[model samples]
Target: FHAIMNLFLLPLWFLSGAMFPISGAAPVLQALVWVNPVSYAVSGLRHGLHGFAETPAVLAGPAVCLVVTGGFALLTLAVAVWQVRRPFFQT
Candidate 1:
């Protein structure tokens, strides 16, 4: 639920600029574009739409994002599964 809004709706909201960033907005909001998956999605879509990669091949942003997200997901899932499999108290 939270991820859905963060990953999808926020980008749409930002693009519409309905409540933010016409020329002046919070620096934090501007910086969020770098980490929010929506930003990556938008940038990637723009590249595809324009028939060229948005960033140079040397760019590591996407790779870093993928690894970080992947690692977090895996780590959380592992912890959850471990907790399920190993109770705090056993008989």
Candidate 2:
């Protein structure tokens, strides 16, 4: 079910306006496009193509992305290490 849901999501995302612009649609319907997770891909594509990009928390560029991603990875690693050592402390 997980894999099936993932597969369906990819195409559904495409139809939800991630593939192209959907102008003249009703306001409510357009709102759906904006809310769709896949719509982010479209926003990114549009921004990249137009040479005007705005990623979330934009004041931070590649450096920030790198730092954030690395920080999260390190946090995960630390948690994993603690879990591994937890049995030793149970006594």
- Model 1: residues with Cα > 4 Å off, grouped in runs: 1-8, 11-25, 53-91
Task: For model 2, name the residue pairs that clash.
Answer: none
Write model 2 residue lDDT over 1-91, tens digit each, in one string: 7997689577657656645555655777677765554454445445455554554322224444345446655876998898788877555
In terms of TM-score, which candidate is strongest?
2
TM-score of each: 0.37, 0.40
- Candidate 2 regions exceeding 4 Å error are 1-3, 53-91
Model 1 CA RMSD to the hidden true structure, in angstroms:
6.8
Clashes of each: 0, 0
Question: In model 1, how large is the Cα lDDT of residue 84?
Answer: 84
